[model samples]
Target: MALGVVGASVCLLVFLAILSLDIMGFLSWKNQFPVDGKTVLLTGGSQGMGRGLGKLLAQKGANVIIVARDVKKLQAAVEYISAAAKSQTQRFHYIAADVTSEAENIRLLEEATTWNNGQTPEIVWANAGAAKPGLFLETPLETMRRQMDINYWAAVYLAHTTLKNWLYPSDASAHSTTIQAPRHFIITSSSVAWCNIAGYGTYGPAKAALRSISDSLRSELNLYNGARRSTATTTKPAPYDVKIHAVYPGSILSPGLELENQSKHPVTHELEASDPHQTEDEVAAAAIKGLERGDYMIATNWLGQLMRVSGMQGSPRDSLLWDTVGQCITSIAWLFIGPDMEGKVWNWGKKNGMPAAPKS
Candidate 1:
C-alpha cells in the first residue's frame, strides 16, 4: 500500500506538470491580441529591434510611444515612425529617463500613462535592456551591476511601476464580452527559458529573471479571469483590459549588427543569412503579429527549446536554475520589436549568438 501510494503521488505530480505545460502552450499559441486603436509604449524603441517594432505598431494603427535614453535617436525614430504609423491617429512618442533607475521607472510610468491623451498606452513593451559579454573572471563588478541594472532591474521596475500605475487600473475598467481588451503586457524573453548550451552566466541570469517574472505574473493574473474568479469584482470593466504575454524566440540579427559585425562568412555576409538571424524589422513584424494573436511564449528564436528537451540539470536549485535559464535563454534569440512589450525579453542576436562571454 505504501509503494502504491508513492507511485500514485508521483503520477499525480507528473500529470499536474503536464497539465500546466499544456495550458501554457495553449496560451502561447493565442495570437488574437487586439490593437485596433490603442496607445502603445515601447522601451528601447529608439533603435535596433525596438525601432522596428515601433514602425510596425504604427502601421497597425497603434499610436507608438518610443522610449530610450538616446535623445537624438528617439527624435529621429519619432519622425520615421510618425510617417509609418498608417493610423489616422498618427504615432506618438516619449523619451525615457533611463529605464534602469528606480526614479526613472517611476517617472516613465507617470509620463507614459499620460501619453496619447490620458489613454495610458494600453499596450506596454518593456524591451529596454543592455548586455556586456566577457569571461566570468574578467567581467568587472561594474559590468555585472550594469547588466543587472539595464537588463534585469530596469525592466523589472518599469513593469512593476507601470502595472501598478496603468495596467491594474485598466484591468479594472475592461468590460465583459470584450474578447480582446485594450491592454496587453508583452515581455521579450529569450529561448533560454528552456535550455542552456554555452556562454550563459551573465546574460543568462538576466533573461531567466524575465521568465520567472512571466511565469509568476501570468499565474496570478490568469486567476482573475472568469475561469477562476467566479465572484470577482475587478472584471466589471474598470478602465483597462489586459493580457500579459512573454515571447521567447530565436535569433534575429538586428540592424545594430550591420556595423557591429566583423565577420567573413557569407552566412554572415548575405542579407538572406538564415544563420538563425533576423533584422530588427523582421523581429518587430513578428512581435506585432504575436501580440495580435495574444501569444505568451512567441518563440521568436528557439535554441533554448533544444536545451530544455535535452534533459540537463545543474545539481543545486540556484545553480540549476541559472544554468537551465541561461541555456534556455542563450538557446533562443529573441528580438522583440513592439511598442508595448511589457516584461518581455528579446533573445535574438548576431555572430556567435549564445552570449558566450565570461562573467568575470
Candidate 2:
C-alpha cells in the first residue's frame, strides 16, 4: 500500500511538471492560427494528398488556389473543393502550370495573386513532388535529374518567388491593410530524408536536399523578421509574420506512392513494413494540423516522428522537454536498431539481383 501511494505521487509530480512546462511555453500550448477566410495557394493540388488538402482547407472557408500541370485533374480538384466548401463565398481556383520551371513558378505566383484579388496567399503549400526508385548505378542520369528538378528545385523556385514577390516584397505597395494575416510556408518532404532505405537512391537524396533548404529558409526568415522589427518605422506595415513548416511524411496511399511502389525493390517493402502507410486524407489532415499548431517540423506517424527526433537538426522545438527526452531515447535506440535494419536490407539486396546498369 505504501509503494502504490509512492508511485501515484511520482506520477502526479511528473504530470504537474509537464503542465508547468506547457504554461511556460517550454511545450507548445499556444492557440492555433485561424485559417478561416484566408487565401491559400497549393501546388501539385491536382490529385492525391494535394487534392485532399485543398478540399479540407476549402471546407474551413479558405480561398484555395490549386496549381498543377494537369488541367483536367486541376479542374476536377477545384470542383471537389468548391462542392465541399462550407461558406457560399469560399472560392476555389486552379492554375495549369508546371512547377519545375522557375519562370513557370513566377507566372503561377502572378496568377495566384491575381486570382486572390491582388492579395498574396496567407499560406503557400509547396506540395509538388515525384520519386523514381531503382538501383543508383542502374538509374538513368536523366531520371535522377528529373527527380531533383521536380522534388527539390521546384520547391526552391516556388519558395523564392513567393518570398520575393509577395511575402517580403521590395515594393511598399504590396502591403495591404486588408490582408495582413500571418503567413505560413509549408513544404512536403519525405521520411526517407532521415529514415533512408535501399532502392531509394535518387528519391531519398532529393528529399534530403529539400530538408536542408527548408532549414536554411527558416533561419533566413528568422533573421529577416528580426531585422524588420529592429528597423521598423511608422511609415511601413509591421513585418510579415512568416513561418516555415517542413513535413516529413511516411508512406501514403497516393498516386505518387503507388507509382513508387510499382518499381520499388522488394527490400524496400521490408524496410517500410514497420510503418503502415496512411491514406491521402490522413496525411493531409496531419499536415494541416501541424501547420495550424505552428510546428516547424511535421511527421504523420510514430515511425516518422521517431525518425525525425532521431535525426533532428536545428528545427524549432515545439516541446523542449518532451522533444529533448524523445531525442535522447531515439538517439540511443537508433544506435542498435538502425544498423540491424540496414543489415537486413543489405542481405536482401545481395540475395536479389540489382537492376541492370543504364546503357552507356
Candidate 3:
C-alpha cells in the first residue's frame, strides 16, 4: 500500500511538471498578441499603469493614442509615448475626454476612428478606473455611484461602442478587406475583484462586474470567430476576430496608491501587507507577457493569480490543467486564509470598539 501511494505521488508530480512547462510558454512560443503597426487606443493613459503600458506598446511598434480627462496630462503623455516609439514613423496622439459618460464614450470612439484614418483601432484598452475605499456604510453613496460609473460603466460603454464599430462598420470597404490579425479589447480590473476583503466594499464590486463583462465577451466573441472560420473560402467572411482580455493587478505603487492610502483603513492595511506591491512598469510588463501568451485572464503577480483561481467561480479558465491545479491549491489555502482574515477583523473590532465617525 505504501508503494502504491508513492507511485501515485510520483505520477502527480510528473503531470504537474509537464503542465507547468506548457503554461510557461515552453511548449508553444507563438506571440498571440502582436501589436506591431497596429493602432491601440488606451483609456486612462495620463498616469499610472495606463501610461506605463502606452510606452511599452509604443516601444513594440504600435501607433498609440492615449485618452484621459486631463488635457495637460494627456499632452505630456503623448510626448512620453512618442519618445518610446519603435521608429520615427510611428504615430502617437492623446485625447482629453471623460469616459464615465455614455455619450462621451460614443464621441470618443468616433474621434479615434477618424484619427486612425477611418479605421477603428485594432486594440482598445479600458483602463480608466478609480477606487474609493471605506467601510460600506461610511463611504458616501455618491462615492459608491462614482466608483461604479468610472470602474464599471466606463468599460461597458467603451466596449459597447467599439464593438459596434468593429463588428458592424459603416464603411463597406472596411469589411471587404481580408485582415488576418485579430483585434484585442482589454479591460483593467483589480485583484480585489476576486478576493473582496473588508474596507473595499465600494471598490471591489465594480471591478468584479468588469471581470464578469470580460468573461462574457470572451466567450461571445467565439461566435464571430467560428463564423469567420466557416466563411473563410467565401468572398465575404466575418470582419475580424475579436479577443477579450482582463488584467488583474495587485497593489500598485503609483499616484493612485498614494491617494488610496490617504483614506485606507488601518485594518485593511494590515490585511494587505503581505501582498506584493508592484510598480506601474512591472505590472504593465507582466500584463503584456500574458497577452502575448493569449491568456484571457491576466494576473500581474503571484498573489493576484492565486486570488484569481480562488474565486474563479465558473468563469473560463486560461489553462484548464494549470488553473485546476491552482484552484485546488488555493481552495485549500483559503480554508485557513479566509478564516484568519475574518479573525483579524473580528479581533480588531473587539479591541477598538467602533471607528471614529466621518466628519461632516
Instruction: Please report, in order, the local distance difference test score of every candidate based on alpha carbons.
Output: 0.62, 0.83, 0.90
What shift in Å separates residue 178 of candidate 3 from its native position after superposition?
2.1
Off by over 4 Å in 3: 1-27, 230-237, 357-360
- TM-scores of the candidates are 0.68, 0.88, 0.90
True-vs-predicted CA distance for residue 235, candidate 3, Å: 12
Ranking by lDDT: 3, 2, 1
Which 10 successive residues of model 1 have the least lDDT summed?
337-346
Task: Please provide, for model 2 over 115-139, each residue's C-alpha lDDT reduced to its tens digit, 9 standing for 90 to 100.
Answer: 8877678789899998889767767
Candidate 3 RMSD to the real structure:
5.2
| Model 1 spans with C-alpha error above 4 angstroms | 1-31, 167-182, 226-241, 255-275, 302-360
- lDDT tens string, model 1, 185-237? 77876665454222334555787788778767766665544332355463343
State the RMSD for candidate 1: 10.8
lDDT of 2 at 164: 71
Going through the candidates in the order shown, the clash numbers are: 63, 0, 0
Candidate 2 residue spans exceeding 4 A from truth: 1-30, 167-179, 232-239, 353-358
Residue 169, model 3: lDDT of: 72
lDDT by residue for model 3 (1-360), tens? 999999999999999988887865545669989999999999999999999999999999999999999999999888988998999989998888899999989998899989999989999999999787888878888899999999999999999999878776787766766675888999999999998988999999999999989989988888777776674545454467888999999898888999988888888988998889988899999999999988889999999999998888888777877789999999999899999999999998999899887655
